[model samples]
Each structure stands twice: as structure tokens, then as C-alpha cells.
Target chain A: MTSNQDHLPTGQPDDGAPRGKVIVSVDAMGSDQGPSVVVAGCARSARSDSDLGFLLHGDSAVLEPLVARQPALTGRCTIVHADETVTMDDKPSHVMRHGKKTSMWSTIGALKSGQAHAAVSCGNTGALMAVSMIQLRRMEGVNRPAIACLWPARGKHGFNTMLDVGADIKAEAEDLLAYAIMGVTYFRNGFGEERPRVGLLNVGTEEHKGRAEIKEAHELIADHAEIGRYEFVGFVEGSDIPSDRVDVIVTDGFTGNIALKTGEGTAKLVADFLRESLKSSALALLGAMLAKGALGKLTARIDPRRVNGGVFLGLNGTVVKSHGSADATGVAAAIGLAAKLAQSGYHGRMAERLVIAAQAVQNAADASAQNGDRS
Target chain B: MTSNQDHLPTGQPDDGAPRGKVIVSVDAMGSDQGPSVVVAGCARSARSDSDLGFLLHGDSAVLEPLVARQPALTGRCTIVHADETVTMDDKPSHVMRHGKKTSMWSTIGALKSGQAHAAVSCGNTGALMAVSMIQLRRMEGVNRPAIACLWPARGKHGFNTMLDVGADIKAEAEDLLAYAIMGVTYFRNGFGEERPRVGLLNVGTEEHKGRAEIKEAHELIADHAEIGRYEFVGFVEGSDIPSDRVDVIVTDGFTGNIALKTGEGTAKLVADFLRESLKSSALALLGAMLAKGALGKLTARIDPRRVNGGVFLGLNGTVVKSHGSADATGVAAAIGLAAKLAQSGYHGRMAERLVIAAQAVQNAADASAQNGDRS
Candidate 1:
């Protein structure tokens, strides 16, 4: 299937045709709901953007019936038959074994072969990361891939980008600097921020209060001349995240994962609690009627579906990771994010910046050595 | 120093006898605000709980003025002069170097010397953990120390205990099993729960969805006879945390810290958002007025301050960690928690449970080995 529509804005209407028209391949069989929800999302995404195309990878038997149900989805999205499906429980090593057979692996192959600008998945995140790494390989300087999510701040300044959501569990302080650079590049490209402020997530604002790695990394980033263009704010506690104090919040993958999940869970709990509390009594119900519109608007704004997608930054090619349990709406949102990132050249800009950042880190070491010798 | 009053819910009315009393050594100079707030919290706690005593550790001169300003506090809390203070920036290695003089170190020393049953700190968490490890030591059978917190669950079965909130970042699968058993013991003793169901936090409810360590730990816990006594309900995602589906949640320190912070941040954000939305229009305000009491009760119930203190579960002696930013009420609640733990011999029970659980794990391993051989 071919379309000559150019690119569109993620959620809103297309303002102008994007510079680069890039195809994004969606692994239809990756998520829990299988090809139907993914196909519907892909259909919705493809309709919104001109430059987007989908290469649906799944069992033709299962996928064809679902695609047949939506005739409008037939032309915009292409179904590429692949008998292999990656189970959520499958070993990452085993999936990496057949690089071209499985839908998940083949989707990454599509990116490597330039059939797709980026690959989006709600599948086994581990297998996706593993396949992405082995197939596309890491960019010149990136040590490990990081999952970056856009978090909405309280004020009007917009969402803050955070990273290392679930890719690397035990990241060193140096790895954190990489996350900072990548996260900054993402915000610069995706959010169009030239110089985003990067805040290191710590238990306290004091630079030396965290672990040895955090302290060491703090010195490295704060002193680096190359990072001068990017605003390097000091430590930010978890409380500062919802505030519009910083543009990029950087932490290790383990912490980032927990933060994302907890934020999601708490938001759900809050929404549920409000609904239950509002209907408890007749007076409360009357109060709810008066405040219904405002509450609805607030819920819609804070809904996880509205902010469904996150990009896996620092990878060789763009890989957007949607929440595994995301429904059609969330999936659609993720597709939109991927489409926008592809149009914005988010990965390319980040890759370029990372190379320079890595070199600067090396140069600083050499300068430090020279100074020591001179003394 | 003594007052006969039934201020708090204790077994007996104040009899002017300090029966089953708990003396907490506070590092008055450890926190950001210094001795004043610590002293204030101490006095409040002392007034509320007559069976409590304090050996406030800090510089006598600095504390003397603050003590002199409040005659009521002077008799309630006694000052132990520790000339130096461990600044937040002090190196953990060097933290204990001047242990004899620093307020934080001396406070820990009190716990070590049996002058205090527990040491409370709102200071440098890392330094406190370091000094505590050096002084009080880890509980027998615990390979790594864990910071256990009571997570507020929906439907109010009190609070669900979970941990390794900020300690043991790089933990093994076996360590997680140890944490689960430890958490079960903690919930049982601290909250008096019978057969608390334990869940390993993962990306999904599926047993094999998580990393290798989680999968292994899941199998280990499920098979262990002692662990089996407390329902090993398998994997739980972040959403399950607030649902009260499980009474105990176990994960590594890295994720636990993130989850804790995320919960705190989101709770505050939601509360703020609700308050903001409620003020948008006259009707909304009217509605809010109608449900004011219910909303107030709900807010008070979910307030993090009520469950502010976290127990450093794997310590040989009961060491409760109050939030660094906790106010007087939070500190008092923590003191009450510590007192109860000390009174209940919580540490000893934990030790006993751990030994049994470890033996069960070993037995299960041997049985599995025999089955594998036969196969």
C-alpha cells in the first residue's frame, strides 16, 4: 500500500507537510490484543498523517479476517504475512536467533533495510530491545538503549521528557550522562526545544547526597563544556517532576520504569477515587453534577491514553514503545508519536548530538591528564 | 521528664513508670533544619507518648539555646553532645571516620550500645544507612538491607507493606525471595496480618514477563514451603499496588524507590489538580461544598504523612526512617511505629521467619534437583 500524503502532527491536524516522509512499521501481532487493535490504531494513524505507511507483520490467517472487517483500513495499511509470532514469554536470546523470521524481528529488519523509518511495538519490551540492538546495532556512541516518556507538567510549558524507563537496570553514572544527552536531543527535536534543561533525579537536591555514580556523573555533566548549550540543572527530587521546573528528567532504567508505572497507577487510582467519592451521597451527586464538566475535562487531560506513547531513545533507529496494556486509543497515540518523531528526525538529531557528547567526554579526560602532567 | 497522662493509645494509662519504653536517639544536627525541628518533633512525641525517651545527639551549644526557649521540651528530651555533624555532602567512607563526634554517627552508636532501641533520622539517608550497617549490623539471614514502607492501598486494609525502597539496587533473584519473606514477617509483626499474600512487582501479571531475576524469584517463592504458607500470588504490576490485591509487594530497591516517589508525587499532583478543578466555577464550588466532608476524609486517609515512616527491615535492631521532609506529626507517627516494633520484638520475629524461609528454599531446591535427576 502506498500513500503520498507527507507528514501530519501527532494528535492535532496537519499544519504543514514535514520535510522527510518516513514509513513506520507497526508489529500488529506484538501487543496483547493481537492485530485488530493495532490495525485499527495503524488505520487511524495513517489517516491523520500523509507521510505514514504501515507494514503489518502477523499471521495472515488471523490478520486478514480483522483487516477484512475494516475495508477502509485495507488500502492505507499493508499486511505482510509472517507465520512466526514472538510470545511474551519467549527468551530474548531465542528471538534474536531467527533475525528474519518472527514478526517482531522482521519489523526491526524493515527499519534496518530502510523499509520503515521507525518500528513501533507493544510487544515483549525485552525481545524488542534485544532484536533492535542486534538487528540495527547501537549507534556509534550509545552504550545502551533508553526508553523516554513525555510527562505532562502542571503549568502550560508542556510535557517534560524522562528516560531509561526500562532498558538498562544497572546504569553507571556515565550512562546517566548519555541518557541526559539523548533525552535533551529528543526534547529538542520532538518538542522543538533548542536548549532543554536536564535535571538528574535524586533523593535530594544536594549534588553529593546520592550514590557514588550519581555524584561522579554530576561532576562530569556540570563541568563538561560541550553540554553548555543544554541547561544543566542540579538534582531534582521526585516531587519536582510534576512541576515545570525542568524539561528533561534523567535516571536509570529501573527507577524510570517504576516512576512511569507508579505515575500511571496513581493516576488511575485518583480517577477512580474521584468517581467513587462523587457518587457516594445525594448531595455529593448534586455537587458532581455541578462540577461534572470540569471534572470530565480534567480527567481527559490527565488520562494515560492522551499521553500513551514513549520513544526508546539512544537506539540505532527510532523505536517507540507503547504501554503493553494499552488499548486502541493508547496504541493510536503511540503511532502518532512515532509518526511525529520520524517526521521530526528525532533519532537522527539525537544520534548526531550523542557522537559529539561522547567525544567531549573523551576530550575532557585527555585535558585532565594533560593538566595533571603539567602540574 | 515524666508526665502521667493518657495521651496516646497504649496498654495502660500513664502510671509515671516507663514500662516497655523505647528510647530513640535522634541526630538533631543531621537534617536540613537542624536541631530546632528535630527537638520540636521530639517534644511533641514525648508529650504524646510518655513511655518514650530521647537522647538527642548534636552540639550542646547550638541545641542549648533552642532548648532554653522551650522549658516544656527541656525536661522531656535530654541532649547528648556530639560536637560535629555529618553534612549531607560527607563521604560515606569518611562518615564513620569522625563517628565519635558527629551527631549522626553518635545517634547510631546509641542504638549499638543499647541506650536506644532504635535510631530515627531525617538526615542523609545514605550516611545513616552506612552508619547503621556499621553499627547495628544486618539481621541474621539477611544478605542485604531493605527499606520497607507501608504503601496505601485502596479499600483500606490498613496499608500494604513493600520494600527495598532505596537500598540493595543490584539485587539477585534469591535476594528478592529473601525480601518477600522479610516483608511477610514485617507485615505480620508490624500490622499483625495473618498470611499476607506476597507479590513480586513486574511489568505484567504473567509469571515469565519480567527479567530473569524476577522469573527465578517467582519460581523460588512459589516452591518454598514457608513462603507458600504466605500465599505466593505470583507477579503483580504497578496498578495492583493501589488495589489491595496483595498485602505485601516486593521488588529491588531501585524500582521500589521509583514506585515510592511516583506514588508520592502523583498523590500530591492529583490532590492539587482536584483542588484546582474544584475552584473553576461557582457550581463546582457548590458541589465541592456538598461533598466537602467526604472529600476531606478521603484526602486525610490517603495523606502520605499518616504512613510517613519506613522501617529499615533487615537491621538487627528496629530502625525506622522518617521522610527527610517530614513535619512534626510525621516524625511522631514514626516514633509510635518504632515504639510498637520494639515492644513487639519485631526484629527477632523477622529473624526467626527468615531462617525458616531460607531452609524452605533450600529444601525446595533439593526436591527440585531430585525430580530433575529422575526426569
Candidate 2:
């Protein structure tokens, strides 16, 4: 891959992928569906864009034949053999202490060694985060790394960037400020929303609502909006997430994770109920059959597989965690996100913005300390 | 107003409202739709159940003509005239300090004066809570009052009781335990579920997940479950809110409020998307027309108005807060909930249960404190 290939635009994709040679390392053995699905997903991703490549990490004996069967991945992938694979039940601490040779660890190692611009895994989230943090490490000036996922919303970009979804349980006022800054950049780069509108997630849209931490975070984010290169939409309620009112929604991991799951569960329950209603009578069933294409479109829009990846933000190297139970389509979506981030040089830009934001944070603290002294 | 009226079964209703002659105090002028909708809603409630009556608190000049037009309300409702109405923009503090003569205040006063079994208002939530807290006061062992709402769920009861939705932002371990006890009682009495399973909402279902407060509350709730007459299901994730596995979900006001709104927003967004897809083409439109009845049923199942009330728990007197913008149907649903609680003697039963749970809590705290001293 030449240096020129790195400059190729990924935002306005011509073939649904970056028009550049970008390799995303995959933990082939970590997926619930095993190496076959991982290889198939890689093939599916590569089929669309010939410039895409993969460094598959797993047992060569298992992954070799799997990669070879796919004509699209014939020469587009290389299998990096790993004797161990992280299981769903594997604890993050245990994996960190004794599972260095696991496929997930090897997958992160590829990014560390500059073998792959990005990494994708359908493994245990805790173990993956543990391995990535230990290997790739947090980006400079980041107190904690956050996991960002795209939420389907009423936006021109078709989504909103939501951060700190189960990355860490607690986010203080300062940490929330960092999340806001990072979330802003993530939305701008990922969704091409320049000056993305950011909102602090709270119980109510009112300024007086929520915990003390949330109130302080609201002030900090609002104060630093200009420096963060985003419009501060103040406090937004959970309902505002899917509304077109905001682009980036920032919250602590505890709240963010719950909101994400709650949103998904609600959508699923509604779909299930609608399906049951449609099947109640013969006329309704016939109507369902006639509107099959339209209903299919609706299902596709709300489908979990359509938005399968949660990108690890505030990390030195980009890593996209695909759902462990994800099939080929889900894995392909995760890989596409990783490829897009890699091609756009998201890491360097995010780090640069964080450094500038950190300086502003320092100046604000200094000014506050001086004021406190005077008082 | 016989004591036998309070003992009459409100559950398994033969009619839509409570069987006995239970008078509900309604703030006629508090609704965003004004006094007309409140009168219409009262009429709707009265039309279905001849046993039900109402004390309508507001300007009699404004409410009289509306109530007269609805013949169902003519003899069932008594107009209690009040000069002022609480506006949505009125702060709770202002309402508490200087707005004593408002319709909201008069409505709650009926409960304190024993003129009404339960109070119903579509007023500003903060003002309602403030007036209720000041007028009726918290129950004997209650730390803070919580607002419990019915969530549509996959259960035989067709709903789950979720508490502390914007009642207050903070709920400590003890407060959470109280919520669990209160929520359990509410679910059992309302849903007719014996030993209703209670779950503490967190990011993950794991025991170690979430903040220290949640973990401590988990143990406290588990310890007092037997005394509280509910089964402890341990920690549940946000996705489990509507799942059949849990019948009662306990959380702080902030998280609970967000979860409620998020769930509602997601459902609404999905419905809107489905509607757009249904009208995407002529064939789809024809199918929609044919399946109109089925779709209407589905819409009704997920409709906000169908479950419009949030019952104020832990108070000395029962209060049901309806949506300020609720229409006639929405207000009727709220009145039904208030009537159900009134007939079932929910306040007395809940208070008795809390007394037992409070003793258990006291014992646990003493033991822990003694252990701390020894250590």
C-alpha cells in the first residue's frame, strides 16, 4: 500500500467502501459463528471494494480452508495463526493475565505492529476492550476510552453518534467534557457532520434536572462548544436521541449502555407486537403480503445487523467490536466501519482535536483556581 | 363513602372503572387541553361506571357548561370552584410558596380532607409533587415519594410497574429499596400478580455491574424481598424492562425517567418509520387501507394515551399524574388507575408493607454498623 492510497476519500464512497488499500485485522476465532462466518464477512466486505484487505487471526488449520473457499478473499486476506481463542465466558482480567496468545490479542497486535490500519472482532466485549487497552493503549490526554455506536435517528446522515456505551461505568463532569469533545469529532468524521450538534443526556431537557455531575458537565460542554467545534444543544432527554434535534449524544457508560439496550429492546418489542397484530386475521395477513417490500424496508431499517459495530473511541488505534452473535452481514458492517475510519485517518485528527481541547480545559481550570484564590 | 367501598375489588374489573362509589378529585383547569377536555374525560369515565364520582376542582364558571354538556358527568361530578389555575411555566417552588389557591392545590386538598379517595391532575409534575408532598405528606416510613408508571410489557398482566420516573433525581440505596418495596406492592395490587418479581435496573445483568449505589441497593432489595412480599430477580439490564422475567423495575428518578422516555421515543420512531414505509408506494397504501383495523390495534397497543398515568407512590394519600397534554381518553385512563388504587386501598396496603420492610432495613443497617465498629 502506497502513501497515496491513504489520501483516498472515504466519506463519499463510490463502491460503498473507501477507494484505498485498507486492511482490517479480524479475530476470526472469537465469533460465535466461528472462522467461516468471519472469513465470509471479510469476503463480503472485500467483494464490494477490491482495495479492501484483511489479516485474519485464528488457527490456520481452521481459517485456511475457510478463506480459500471465498473467491473474493483468495488473495485479499492473510491468515495469522493463533492457537487460542477467547470464549464468551472469558473474564477480562483472566484474559489479560493469561490469554496473550488468543486470537483477539493477536488481532489487536496486528494494529500495534502496523500490519493493519484497523481491527475488527466479534468477541467478548470486556476481553476485547482489555486486550486493546493493554496493547493499543488510550490516546494521549484521554482519561478513559469510550465506545461509540451509531443510533438510527431523524437526521440527514441517517444516524446519531452516541458515546460511552458500556466503556466505563462512571463519568464525572470532566470525563463527560472529554466524551463531548471526542463524540463531537467522532460524529464529524464518521457522519461528515461538520460542527455536529452535541447534547448532554439527562432526565429532562430542563437545566435544573439530573445529578450534580450532569449539571457540571452541561456547563463545561456548553462553555467549550466553540473549541470542541460543535453546537451545544444543552441538556436533552432520552426522547431527543432519535429526534433530529441533535447529532451527538454523550452520557456516562452506565446510562449510555442502558439507553442503547432500552432503545433496541423497545424497537424489538414494537416490531414483535406489530407482527402479531398483522397475523391476527386473514385480511391483515394478505395486506402484510401485499406490502411485503415496504414492510421489509421497515424491518431492514430497524434491523440490529444493519448497524452491527460499536467503535472504540479515545483509543490510540481504531477497533470496531462486532456483535459476537453477528452473522456475515453484521461482521461485514463492522469491517466497513473500521475501513472507513482507517482510510479517513480518524486517529490522527481525533488526537489533534483532543490535544487542543485539553489545553482549553487546562486554561479553564487555571482561571477557576485563580478566581477561587481571589475569593 | 362507606369503609366497605374501600375494600371493594378494583382488580378484574367487570366494568372499566372501580366497582364501588369512589370519588376522584380532578384538577379541571390543569390540563393543556383546558377544562373542556377534563370535563369530557370525567364524563367518559362516568359513562362507563355509574359507581364512580368526581370532585372537579377549578373555576366552576369555566367547568360548569362543559360538564353540563356531558350528561354522564351531570350528577356524578361536583364542581369545586377555584379562582387560579397552575400554568405549565409555574415553578414548583413558586407554586408551593404563593400559588396555594391554584386548582392543583385544591385538588390535592380533597385527598387530605378525605373528600376524595384519590387525586388526578394533568398539571406541571413538579408542582403536583410539591403540593402532594406538602399537603398529604410522605408515608410513615417513606424517605421520599416516587411516581410509579405502568410500562407495556410481555406479561400476563400486560404491563410492568416502573417507579421513580422524575419524582426526584437522587435515590440512594435505601431509597431504591423503598422503591422496590413500593413497586412490588403496586404491581401485585394493580396487576394481580402474586409475589411480583422485582429487578434493579443497571447497565448489565451481572451482580458486579453499575455504580456502588446500585450494587448496595441490589443487596438491600434482595435482603428485604421476603418482608416486602416480592421475589428478588437480582440486577436486570435495560432490555429486561419489558421482559416477562421481571414485573417490577426499581431505579432512581433520573435513570428511570430517561429509560421511560427512551423506550417511548424508540417505539414512536419505529411507528413513524413504519407509517412512512406503508405510504411509500400505491400498493403499500392499498395494503395499509386493507390492514387498517390491524394497524389500529397495533397503534392502540403502543399508544401513549392508553397508559397515560404515573401513580405517585410513598405518599400518605394517593395521586395519579396524567400527562398535561392528555386528551379525553388519556385522562380517562388516569382516572381508571386512580379509581383502581382508591378501591383497592393501595395506600394502606402499601404503607403496611413498607412498615415491615422498614424494620428489616433497620435490622440490616444495625448489623452492618456493628460489623463496621468491630472491623
Candidate 3:
């Protein structure tokens, strides 16, 4: 399926010149709303960021028509044709085996080949993770990769970063510690926090509660906090996930995934309830109209579309998995996040921090072992 | 500490006659608001159900004055003197060892001794669970007891039942199967549902996702659905907990507790945001005033106090735990739940269901083993 489109410009300066712009790989297909939303989102991103460029991966015939509609994105984008798209129903293993020619795979490939700084896709989460793992590979000493998402919280930054949102079903003590390091680094780089406070998610804040692995992970994270450049806030209950006390919450993939989905579901339910109440009567409807501006502000503050990307951490390259059903606005938010991470050199900084933290953990373990032998 | 209160009527019929009233044991101390709230809650419950009586366990000197203030509770109450109170800060093990004379212990003691049909306490949850496990004991063939709570959902009953919401942190496959049995039975008895649909809570509804024990529990539950007298919906996600798809969501204590508290936190956050918006400006305030009636109705629908009891299942007797910070209304709701469970003979019926379900699970395991051997 190799074609003339495969030879498109890599957006990299040749002649040993300094790179002046951040290029983001965009998978312009496989979204539930179709390629139009992806193209529109790219257009929006290009309008906001003049220095941003895109290596759009999909059928060039289809993407060209959409890109032509937006004059701002036309010159900033390079269309690379891919024959196939990764369907949401495709298994991660199936994608790993036979998805090389798909848009999702090609998008991640751009990041691996150094043609793009980061990758953004509104496609199947499992397929994307599988492709990214195979192509980009995990970081050194990282047993499992985690997906970090910025959750809306009652904090100074109005959000907290939580990881292992569903990279794997289980997490060992070391895996959880890795998650803590990754979450802290992600928040620091993505949101510009100097030193984020990390909390281990558990049933209770007490030292005696929760599973054994959680307690072990808590101590490990606490021990490496200084080297990791983050403060350990001990254990935090589920309620504290949205509280201001902690900026990074760490947990196994199972709990994190359930909590993430539960939070989303609850938010939607409350919003629906509020809307139903506001339209219950003629007086209520009229009042809603009068209060539209303030209500709109509240709605915008909690809008999932505003913060729509889940960043894949502990990998060689940055890959953001947006919600499959995201609209143009949500897709734009994901692309914006990817560009910000790339511009800030998040992946390289995160790797450096994790390596230091991992060594400190090893040192602590060795000391504890020697102490046990002496006793 | 023995007083005239100790000799007070037990509410059992005089002249050696059979008891007709459903007597609920109440711990009148250790609430965040203290004894007055408990007395007021008991009085409120008494006013609604004439056949409901209370064995109030606390210092008679403190409770007598409060009971006298509520004249409706005078004839229907029997105060029992207990010299100590289980402080919220006390550890569960400490309570299990040295909390014999505490009001929380005395309240549960009445159920073990069969002096009261059911027990209701608004004390420290960890201490209460410890006392109940030691006092009532787990039912036959049950590995661990579970705490079941009715969650606000979009179901036909406007709620769904979830179990192991912090009774213990870990649950094996057998323990999960037991939770399913207990949860289904609790929903049927409490909400008058003829046959509740059971769903194993996981990160995804797909059969191959989640922890190993979760998958095993799914098959066990599906195997015994007919004998357990419930329909197994295979697996359900966190969002399904608040949806109408299932009536009982079975999970380990860790996930259940996190999901429960997360939902509570999200609800409060959304409510706070809505209130702030409504009061942001004079126009918004005026609009809120016009829509106050509908908003009040909506608030009442999601009010936590309206359904405020967590029922401890898989034990020999029924125990309902109210929120430690519960007010008079919340305490009343707990007492109401205890009375309903007592009146419906929930403990005896649940015990029978569990026995049969447990045997079915054992039989399935044996059959699987035999098949393996034959192969």
C-alpha cells in the first residue's frame, strides 16, 4: 500500500538547522463522529497555535477535501495516506499483529520515526495502547505503562492527575510507585507545577487500611518522594480524588478505571438532573433563561470536552487517547494537550525523573534488606 | 452502672405471651450530634410505626432526659445502661477487646442474645463491624460477611443495592459469590423486588476484562443464578451502578467503597457548583428564587439522608449502620430500615438463600474438578 503520499515532507529541517516548530501526528479517522471532527479540531488547533504543524494520517483523498475547507490548516498540514482504520471492536492483540497499515498505527509510527513530536488519536483505546507499546516501547525499568488523565478537582489548578486509568488490570507495588512518579512528572510538565503532592488511593486514609500492595506502594512512594521531586501526602480516600489536598493520585488500573468511569457517570447524571429541574415548569424555564450566562459558565467549567485526552505515560513517545465519541471541540482539546506536552519536552523530562526515582527505590530496598540480615 | 433502666420493660409481652412488636436495638451515644439526635430519631420512627419498639443502649441519665423531651418515644422505649461509648477514634481491635460495656457493643449484644430483632448504630464503622462480626458471627459456610447499602440509581425503585462497601478490603471468588447472594437477597427483602438482577462490578462489561477473581466470581454467580433466585447480568461497569440495568452490583469492599465515596464526592461537587451559579448575580439569584420549588424537589430526590442505612449481611442477625455524622433524619432512616428488615424476617430468609447458593457453588467446583480428572 506504499504510495507517493508516504514520501511526504517529514517537517524536519535538513541541513543541520535548529527545529523551530512542534509537529503533532494526527489520526484523522476512526473517531465515532468520523474524520470531519478530527479535521475541524486540527483546524481549530492551527488557528490558535501558529507554530504548530500536523502530519495528518489517513486516506489523503478524504482528508484533503476536509483540510481544503480550512485555509489555516492547509499549509501547516502534511497528509500521509493509510489504507485502513482501526475499528473500536478490534482486539489489542489483533491490532498488534496486523494493524501496521491502519491510520492509528501510522500515527504512532510518526512519533517512533521522529517525524512528529507526539501523537493524538480519537480511536479504540486498547488498539492505540497496543500499537504504541509495540512501536514506541516502554521506558527503562518501567514494567507497565500507565494512562494519566487530568481530573477536575477542587484544587488551585482546578485539576489533579491520576494514572493507571486502564493500562493494565493489576499493578504491583513497584508498578504503583512507577505510576506515582509518572503522575507527578506529568502534572509538573503538563500543568507547570514545580512539585506536585502525590496521594495513594485507598479505602481509608489510615495507615492500616486497604490491600497489602497499597500499603507497600504507599511507603515506596513516600521513600522516593525527595528524589522524585514530589511530596507524599500519605493515603487518600476516593473522596479526596477531587479534593484540593493532593495533585496526583496513584492506584492500580482496576480501581482507577472504575473511579474514572464512575466520576464521569455521576457528573452526567447530576447535569441531567439539573437540566430536568430547570425545565420542569414555565417559571423554572423562564428563570433558566435569565440565569443562562452564569449557568453556562458552570457548565463550561465541568465540561468533559474541555479536558478530553488521556496521556499514555512511561513510553518512548507521547500518545494521547481521546474519547472515541468526542466532538470537534473535544478533539481540539486533545490536540492542544498533545502539542503542549510536546512543546514542554514532557516525555524526555518524565523519563529522567522516573530513572532517578527508580534508583532511589532500589537503594532503599537494599538498605532494608541489609538491616533485616543484621537483625 | 446498673440502674432502674436495667429493669425496665424489654417490650416483650407480659404474662409469658409471644412478642408482636419488632424491637430495634439503638446505640444512643457516639453520634457526632450526640444522644439527643438518637432519641429524636427514635421518636420519629416510633411515631410512624406503632408496632416498632426500641432497646435504647446508653447512659440512662443522659438518654432519659432526651427521651422525656420526646413524649412520643416514652411508652415505646426501654433504656439499657452502658457505661462506655465507642469513640470514633478507637481502633477496631481495641473495640473488639475492651469495648464490652460500650453503648455500641451493648446495642449489638441485644441482637446476639435475641432480646431485639435487629440492631441499628450510628457509631464508628470499623468498631461496629468488628463488634458485629464477633457478636453475631458469620452464617454457616460463609467465609466473610458483607455490608450492603442501597445506592441512589435511575432504576425502577430509584435505587440499586451494592455490597462489601468496606466490610473488608479483599474478597476471594467465594467471598464475591457470597456477596452476590447477600446483595440479591437484601434488595429483594428491602425493596420488595421479587427477583433482583445481579451484576458483578468491573472496569468493563466485557467477559474477559478485570481481575482473575472477578472472572471466576462471574462464572460462579452465573452458574448458581437459578438456585440463588436472581438473574446474573454477567458483568457491569461502574456507570451501571447508578443505572437501571441491574438491581444488585456485587464487588469487593475496596472497589465498592471507592465507587460509593467517589459518587458522593462528585454529587456534592456538582451541587456546590450549581448553588454557586444560582447565587452568582442578582439576576441568577432572582431566577433561582423563581425556580426554588423545582430545585427543592430535585435536591430531595438525590438527598443521601433519605436512604441512609448500610445493612450488614451474611451474619446471624441484621444490623443497620447509619452514617456517623447522620442527623436526626438520617438516624430515623436507619431505624426505619432495621424495622423493615426485622419485620420481613430478612436474616432468616437471607441465611437460607446463602446456604443453598454456597452449596451450589461448591457443587460447581466439584463438578469442574471431576471433569478435569476425567479429561
DockQ scores of the candidates: 0.44, 0.70, 0.61
Sorted into a CAPRI-style docking class, model 2 comes out as medium
Residue B324 lDDT, candidate 1, scale 0-100: 69
lDDT of 2 by residue, A183-288 (tens): 8877777666779999999977777667899999998889888877899999999999999999999999888988998998999999999999999999999999
Residue B117 lDDT in candidate 3: 87
- The TM-score measured for candidate 1 stands at 0.85
True contacts kept of 2: 0.76
Report the TM-score of the second chain of model 3 against its true counterpart. 0.92
- Docking quality of model 3: it rates as medium
Best by lDDT: 2
Q: Is 1 or 3 the stronger prediction by lDDT?
A: 3
Candidate 1 vs 2: which has more DockQ = 2
Indicate the residue-level lDDT of A92 in model 1.
75
Off by over 4 Å in 3: A1-20, A60-62, B1-20
The lDDT of each candidate is 0.75, 0.85, 0.84
- How far out, in Å, is residue A93 in model 3? 2.7
- Measured on C-alpha atoms, candidate 3 has an lDDT of 0.84
What tens digits encode model 1's per-residue C-alpha lDDT throughout A226-246?
Answer: 554688888887777777788
Considering just the first chain, candidate 1 attains a TM-score of: 0.91
What clash pairs does model 3 have?
none
Clashes of 3: 0
